[model samples]
Target: MNKKEKSLLAAVVVGVGVAVFKYFTDRPKKQSIKSLFYLNDFSSISKNFSKEEIEREILKIYKEEINLDDKFKAILFLTMIEGIESLEKYNQMAQETLEEYVKQSSKKFLRINKKKKTGRNIYRENFYDLIEATCEPSSLKADIKLGIEECLNGNFKKGQDIFLSSTNSDKNTFVSLVICYFSDELEKLDKSAHKRHVKNALKDDKFLFLKSYIMDKNNMYKEQIDLLNSIEPQNELQENLRLQHLLINLIKTSDIENKNVNLVNEMIESFLSKKHETTNTVLNIIGISIEWSIINENIDFVKKISDMYLQGDIDTYVDCRLYVFTYLIVNFVEKLSEKNKQNFNFMHLNTDKVEILRKGIENNETYYKLYVYLGGETKDISVYKKALDICITKNEFINIMRILLVTETQNKILQSNK
Candidate 1:
């Protein structure tokens, strides 16, 4: 009886051990979403998936993981999406999501009266009031929205005040404040207050560009260049700052013998030597180079850089393109004598180039006036009249009046010469 029992017990123990080891070894390991995506490798990882595919994958992960909360998932999803989408688009979507989350959670916690209406209706009716009651006065999202609204409404002083007063002061907040301070509406603020705000803004390290810009604005070229050199450019912002430094340096040494020209050549060669993955940086370089060429009185160089910009596959904003185009037209007109203006030909401007210039000027009243002025200066009266008609239709009257006055004076001077 002892031998049989011992043998049976040994067999049972061995079988149980085998079963336990197989069960442990064969079970699926719980993979971390973070480890799978590797947030640090976002650009490389995200390029493999389209926006819709990324959205689906994120949803799948969110549903599959019970421990991972919605807020955390949302944050991770946002980080991944940002690598794929433009920064402006990412910021807009993320801010909207945050606003909705804040609104919904605030409604639940603040005990806003639901009345007899359904949840959706109740939220719709009391949304703004609920936000006002529940949002922290210091909330970053709230402050950003408020500041943006104020700026859009042409109340730059109010916007600047809101941005400066933001309790959650960070890089974004400081950036917003700097933008407001630089806006055309800053004229509405007291001169002393505006100066004070600019001084206060220059104190932040993240605002090196703003500080440099202010220095440049005040004609402190050496200081601006020094500040720009002090910055270690890691991204597009810092890179652009470096470019600005180069351009400002060129401007400062314009009167010197060959100094600005040599600097321009160096800048052009430096940019061309690098393999730029981003078109924006390259386009920026080309645009500034064109300006540098004009400053150096190298009309041929201007034409060459303009051709490069027009022919490149760079997808830049309308404003950026318009800035380059405006400079090109201005320089071209300035170089042409009145007798030569009559011989000037618009035939060289191809449809694609015209379309690009038109797209850049569309909806931009200030730019439209500049285009009109350029046309008038070049004796393209037909183009000027057409642009004027469009401006009249769009009710862009203020700049229209200024453009008309300038054009009329120019016409009178030409008539007097005749």
Candidate 2:
């Protein structure tokens, strides 16, 4: 109980208190930096950090990786973040480092090689593989983050080019570019080269829907069917791909040129044979197939789809709702017999379902034209005006065309009647 012993005890207690305070204060700061180690983590930089802090932290992690491949990937991730030009300095640093590494590696290879000139070509191939072929497939997911911004802006061509230009482009980017190609946003390229690229992209199992869609688009149904037949489905998803392939084949090969009713019935029967669990992809195919049937005047197919609609087989899917609405208003409803018309009118009775349809029309640009066309059928000038206003606000050319055509046609008919 002496004064000296009490002073020493107080000093020990104060030292421990300071150390605990320091640990608590520094822990979060260290954790915040450590949490941003991976590319995916870096992709979602929080607003808590300034742009400069993110750049500094990213560079710190990039330098710590100590290997050329890892460093390059980290830089590539930074470059893929949209609208961040400040990070390009890091990309230049990476490029310079890569150049120096390649020079040193080439020198080492040349020293042991019998043919120096051919060794250079071999080195280039290895370099390409090192940067691209050996990188993790998800590295290109960063490119998708940037490309999505362009896609959202309706600059599909720019999005496609961003994907195409990425050295680490993988299945995701390839599939995204395929969507751009189908949209006719991409500039014309060599068709054989494009097909070869598509074939390579289709080898990824995740994009089976894209594979079927491509086959349908290109009228290469026979080739796709043969391919699907060769590979036994490993899972339920693969099985669905096979079913979609067969359904598309039936639609593609039908004698639609001659208005063959039997063939139309056969197609409808084939589609309905598989009680498909309405996945988004399956629903898309259903909508597209029914659209084709409608365009070809397949009344039997329309009736089958209408029956499915009434049964709520496809009530949840946006694509099914869209195409079914289009079919009913344009081709099916007016042609229905009195009894069928009564049944058809029942679809309008579901207030909740009608709300879903209205929400879909409000949110989806694809639905706008169909909504305008339906408005035209009603001879509602106000609906046409509403559609035109929306098209103008969104700068939707196709929707504008639909609105204009429908309005003018209706006006001409009214003039004739008067």
Best by TM-score: 1
lDDT tens digits by residue: candidate 1, 1-418: 5999999999999999999999989998644444444343334335555676666666565445544224333444555454555446545644554444433432222111222221122112121221232233255376656875565433456666776577644334354335533443443456665555555556656445555656665566776767767777666545754775667666666776467667767767666554454344345556566666665566555554444444443244433343445446445645766765454333333334444445445424323544554564466555555444433112232344334433543343334334
lDDT of 2 by residue, 1-418 (tens): 8999999999999999999999998785544643654423443364456666766776777778876555654555455445676656866875665554444433222111122121012222211221232243355457754764464444555666776677655444354435433333344445665666666656655444455556665677777767666767665555555655565566567654354345445655776765666554355456656776667666556556655644442334434244345444435456656665564533533334334445445444333554554564566666655544333112343345434443543353334334
Which 10 consecutive positions of candidate 2 have the poorest summed lDDT?
110-119
Q: Candidate 2: which stretches are off by over 4 Å?
A: 1-140, 168-183, 187-208, 256-277, 285-334, 338-366, 380-418
| Total colliding residue pairs, candidate 2 | 0
lDDT of 1 at 296: 59
Those runs of model 1 whose alpha carbons end farther than 4 Å from true positions after fitting are 1-141, 152-180, 256-258, 274-282, 295-307, 312-374, 377-403, 410-418
TM-score per candidate, chains pooled:
0.47, 0.46
